[model samples]
Target: MSDRPSPGPDVVVVGAGAVGATIAYTALVRGSARRVALHDIDAAKLEAEVLDISHGLSFTPRGSIVGSDDVEVCRGARVVVVTAGAKQKPGQTRMDLAGSTVALVRTLMPRLLEVAPDATYVMVTNPVDVVTTAALRLTGLPSRQLFGSGTVLDSSRLRHAISRRVGVAVQNVHAYVVGEHGDTEFPLWSSASLGGVPVRDWSRGHGGRLDEAELAEIADEVVHAAYRIIAGKGATNYAVALACCQIVESVLRDERRVLPVSTLLEGEYGVSGVCLSVPTVVGADGAVERLAVPMSDDEQHRLRLSAASIRATLEAVGD
Candidate 1:
C-alpha cells in the first residue's frame, strides 16, 4: 500500500448517483481536476460507483477517485457539487420534488458547510433553485458562491432545435433559455444570433424564416424536453451531469465563462432575493457579474413572472 495519504481532491461531488458519477467521469475524461471525491449516505452505492469509475480511470486522462460516506471527505475541495436528494421521475416536474428535496437540502447543507464552507457549492438536486436558495440562506455563504445547473441544458436544447430546423451546426447557434429552469422558463429570442448576425437574417439568407409562432413552438419544446427525456429514460441525468461538470471546470480553472446558470439575484432583472437562471460571468470567485442584456417587453415580462415564482417558493419555504 502507498504510505502517503492521498492528496485532497480538487472537486468533491456529493451524491454518488448518475449525475454525480457522470460529473466525476466527465471531469476525469476532460482533465478538469486532479482528484474527485464522491460522497453519499449509501455506502454500497458509493462503493459501486467508485469501483466502476476506477475501472475506466486507467484508460482515460489522469485523475483519482475516492468514495466515502463521511461528509468530511469534502475537505480542501475547490468546487463542491451537490447532486443529492430525490431525483425527478417520469411525469413529475422538479417542483413536484420540492418539499422532500427541501427537507433533504436542509438536512445535508449544515454538514456540508461545516466541512467545506470554502468550497463553491453547485446545486444539482431537483428543484435546484429552491435548494440552492435554501443553501445560501442556511450556510450564510456569499450568494454568488452557490449556483445551480440551471438553464444551461435548456439553452443547449434550444440551440439544438434551432440548429435542426435551420440545418446549421448547433455551435453556430447562440441562444439562451433564461429564467427558472422549469416549466415557466423562457428563451431570450431577441438577442439570439449567429456570427453577430440576426438569426432571422441568417434564416432569410438560407431561403427561410422562422415565424414568431414557430419560434414559440420551439421554445415550448425546449421547455418540455426535460419532461420528455424523463418520460423516456426515467430520469434526466446525463445532460445535467455534463452541465455540472462544465460549471465545476469553470470554477476550478477560473474560466470566466458565461452560462445561463441559476444564481442569486440582487436587483438584476428588477428582482432580488431569488435564485434564477441568468447569464452570469463565473470564475473561481463564483458568479462575478449578472449580464443585464436588453430584452423585449414580452421577454422581460416573462422573466419577471419566472423570478416571481422563484421568490414565492423561497418565501413559502421560509428559507
Candidate 2:
C-alpha cells in the first residue's frame, strides 16, 4: 500500500497541541474528512483536547472526533499530518525548534509507518521544509507522499496584506510568497496580478501607485508576521491550522490544486536535493509534481539561496 488511502476514517493528526486541535476541528466541521483522530505524547492533555472538541460534535457536523496517546490509532489512516514538534517560542524562528524536534520525528516516523505504512504524510512541524526533507531521508518515503505545509500560510498572509493595501478583495489578489517560509522568503510580485492585470497596471489604472518600497515592506511583514503572533499569543495556530486543512482537503479530495507547498526539488530552477516551498500539484498522492512556474532572475536567485539554507540546515541535523 504505497498509495494514498481512499478518503475515509482516521485522518490522523499527530500532536494535540493548539495547531493540531484546530486542524481536527476544521477537517470535521468543514467536511474535509469524516473521521478526525488526534494523537499526542501527553496522555492527559490529549484526552482533554479530544473531549473539548468532541463536545461540539452535535453542533458542528456529523463525524467522529477521537484522540489517543497511542500512535497506532493512526494505522491505515488516509492522511497523517505531523504537527508533533516543539512549539515555537516568542522571537524564535521555526528552525529554532528543529534540534528539539529532530529526535521526536526520528522516533515517531518509523513507528507511524509500521502502523500506517501507506498513509500520506503531511509534515506540519516547524522548520517545515527542513523537517520534511529530513523525514524523507529518514523514512525513504516517496517524495509524492511526503511534503510540508510550506508557504501556503505565508502566501495567504501576503495575499491578505496585499489586498488590504490595494483596496481589493483578498480573493481577487493573485500573489505568492515563495522561497523559504522564514526571514528569507520572497513575494512573487513579478507574476502578481489582480484579475489578470499586472499589479502595477492595476494600481496605475486605478489612479493608485504603490512603490516597490511599499511592496517590500508588505513582504517583510508577511515573513515576520508569525513571530509577532507568537510573541502576542505564545503560538500562532488559527491560520496555520486552516492551512493544514487546505492541504488535507486537496489530498483527500484529490483536488489536484496548484498550491505553494514544500516538496522535494530536483533541479527545478537549478534547485536540487532540498525541500522548499514551490508551486506544486498536490492531490490524492500528496505533492504530485512541481510546476515549472516562471521566475524572475532575482526570484530564482533568492530561491536558490533558500534551497542552500535548507540544505545546510538538513546537513547540520545529520540528514
Candidate 3:
C-alpha cells in the first residue's frame, strides 16, 4: 500500500549472550530472514559469536549476519528478541532475578523503541514473565506486541519426557507446562494427548501407568532442567535461543503456531492483569490471539496460583 520497499531483516536478536546469540544463528540456519542482526553491549562476545556463526553461513540455505551495539540495527526488524540479563544461580528461581533484569529492560526499551517501534518484542530473559510485564509497561506497547518466550521450551521438554515414558514420538505428544516458568509451574494434563488420544486413557488401556505423583516428578524435572544445565555448562542459553528463533520464524513467516508463551492476561482463566504462559497464536502481527485451552478445576486453580506468584514477583521488582 505504500511506496517504501518491504524490509528484509526479518528479525534482530539483542544481547548476544548464550540465548540471544543462538537465536540469531538459528534464524540464519532456518533461512527465516534475509538478514539476522546480532546486537549486544558486549563487543567481544558479539564478535566471537558472529565469527563462530559466520563459518557455517556457507552451509546454510541463505542469510546475512551483522553484530553491533547500535540500536539502529533494530530498525526494520519484524521481530526483536530480548535475551539480555543476569544468569541464574543454582538454587534460585527465575523470578529471583526479576528486580535487576526489570531495571535493565527499563533502560534498554526506550532506546529500542526509537529504532524498532513496529517490531514485535519477544522477551527471553530469565524471570521472563516479570521482565516481559515490565517491558510492556515501560514501552506502553500493545499486549500482543510485547510478550515473553514463556514456557514453550518447558512444554517441549514435557512432551518429550512424556513421549519417552509412553514410547511415542515427541511430536505425537501434545502437552504444556504452563505458569510462572519455574517451581510454580504446572502441566496442563487435562489437555494433553498422544496423536489426539488422551494420555491418561491411553496409558490405562495399554496397561501403562502414571499417577499424579509421577507427573509432578516429571514436571519438577522439567522446571529444574535449566538449573541443572547451567550448573554443568555455566549457562542455559542455546535451548532458549532456539526457542526464540522458533517464535521469530513463526511471526516473520506468519505461521500462526500456537505456543505456550508469556502474554499479559486480561480475564483469561479468571486471572486478570498479569503476565505468564498460556497457549497463544504468534504470527506476522505478533501474538494474534490466545488459544484458550480448557483446564480441569485443579489445573485452573493452580494456574491462578502461579499467576499470583508472578504478580508477587512483579511487585518485588517494584512493578
Question: Against the unseen true structure, what C-alpha lDDT does each candidate score?
Answer: 0.84, 0.86, 0.85
lDDT of 3 at 289: 96
lDDT of 1 by residue, 236-303 (tens): 77777777778888888899889988888888767788788989888999887889887999888898
Worst 10 residues of 3 by lDDT: 200-209
Q: Please give, for residues 138-217, the per-residue lDDT of candidate 2 as tens digits.
A: 99998899888999999999889878877778888888878877877898888887778777666655645668888888
Kindly report which residue stretches of model 3 are placed more than 4 angstroms away from their true locations once superposed.
1-8, 204-207
Pairs with steric clashes in candidate 1: none
How do the candidates rank by TM-score, highest first? Answer: 2, 1, 3
Off by over 4 Å in 1: 1-6
TM values, all candidates = 0.95, 0.95, 0.95
Measured with C-alpha atoms, the lDDT of residue 169 in candidate 1 is 81
Question: CA shift at 55, candidate 1, in angstroms?
Answer: 0.3
By TM-score, is 2 or 3 better? 2
Q: After superposition, how far is residue 146 of candidate 1 from its true place, in Å?
A: 1.2
Could you tell me the C-alpha RMSD of candidate 1 in Å?
1.9
- The reply for model 2, stretches above 4 Å from the true place, is 1-10, 204-207
Rank by lDDT (best first): 2, 3, 1
